[model samples]
Target: MAKSNNNNRNMSVEEAGKKGGEKVSEKYNQEHFEEIGQKGGEKTSEKYNQKHFEDIGQKGGETTSQKKDKEFYQEIGKKGGETTSEKHGEEFYEDIGQKGGNRSRGGRSNR
Candidate 1:
């Protein structure tokens, strides 16, 4: 018989696994983690509305522009465009362009 971790006590593999699993569950319950994540997301959403989100995004873009040159953005944009084009057909771009043209035809009046 093999000696277990507990002094000179002997334990089976099944018993050891069961004991470790129970200890892990007691230490970190899955539900508790999910509850915290939901609460944080709710708080963030409450603070950052649509317009505020746009402003924050613009500021981040400005900072990134200062840090990186045009080539960096162009390369990233090329990769993103390639990925999107692969995922979506050409018609998707055409449809969105038509919608954008329609929306912009009247300038801010349409907005």
Candidate 2:
């Protein structure tokens, strides 16, 4: 158990982690975290291949899907759609729709 100086009560692993993370965040800027994350990602990419990533992604997706209900997925999908709509204009959707239509009919070659 971890103890915080502020209180006599024992801190949980989660609470200690949150406190540590907050302290680190206060000390560092966004770029510092971004650089660390990039280096970690590069190291992970060097260690694992496409198939390993695909396997983990599939497993994670399966676990998440099992834990979440249809309404949860619908809510997330709606939120994502709203965010995308805000970022893109009508022309963007038109172009994507055209590309999708062409792909479905095999009118254009795959990228």
Candidate 3:
């Protein structure tokens, strides 16, 4: 019964694509990714401007926040911080802090 239920959840091509995209990316070389990414970015920029980007980003953020609770975000944030700390070391935080400080030099700015 359980095996049949699990088998019922067979993947479609799109689902397979989404699941294996990371594996495919891992198999490829960096230059291939960079080239394809640049092409995709160019196409996206051609189709959508600043306002379009802002609208999609806003919608995505809102939908994600609604779907996931505070604890979910906190866990991901902690994991991301740990990964960054491992890869870049403490100096990475100092550089980022200075960059962030430079960006917010003036009074409170509106997003």
Candidate 4:
């Protein structure tokens, strides 16, 4: 049993490579990899944005407790816009269309 465990722990390059290939084939099936990758990437970006927004919210709350006014809100909005532009490039704003105070659930069809 000890010898069997030792043998299991040591793998030849060909055996290890074959195992790796099997894992790639099994986990990244041709029909699902692209969809899985896209979902994972979107989730990652959403989490990042949520964390960033939460931090901004905390800072805004702290500042409001000290001195709150329309100017304070405007300043936060301006800073957020500037930071968004800087991170995503100036063309980012053009990608989003204006809404007449009614936005869909993220571009889903009405039907």
Best by TM-score: 2
User: Residue 55 in candidate 2 has what lDDT?
Assistant: 100
Models 1 onward score TM values of 0.48, 0.80, 0.53, 0.29
Specify the highest-lDDT model's number.
Answer: 2
| Candidate 2 Cα outliers beyond 4 Å, as residue runs | 1-15, 108-111
Give the clashing residue pairs of candidate 4, or none: none
Name the lDDT of candidate 3: 0.82
- Tens-digit lDDT string for candidate 2 (1-111): 988787688999999999999999999999999999999999999999999999999999999999999999999999999999999999999889989888898887545
RMSD of each: 9.9, 3.4, 8.5, 14.4
lDDT of 4 by residue, 1-111 (tens): 122235467666777677778988886667687888899998977778777868888999888768888887898899998888788854555445433222555655443
lDDT of 3 by residue, 3-97 (tens): 22355876667767766798897899999989999999999999989999999999999999999998999999999988877899778888777
Rank order (by TM-score, best first): 2, 3, 1, 4
Q: Which stretches of candidate 1 lie over 4 Å from their true place?
A: 1-39, 97-111
Put the candidates in lDDT order, highest first: 2, 1, 3, 4
Task: Judge candidate 2 at residue 93 and give its lDDT.
Answer: 100
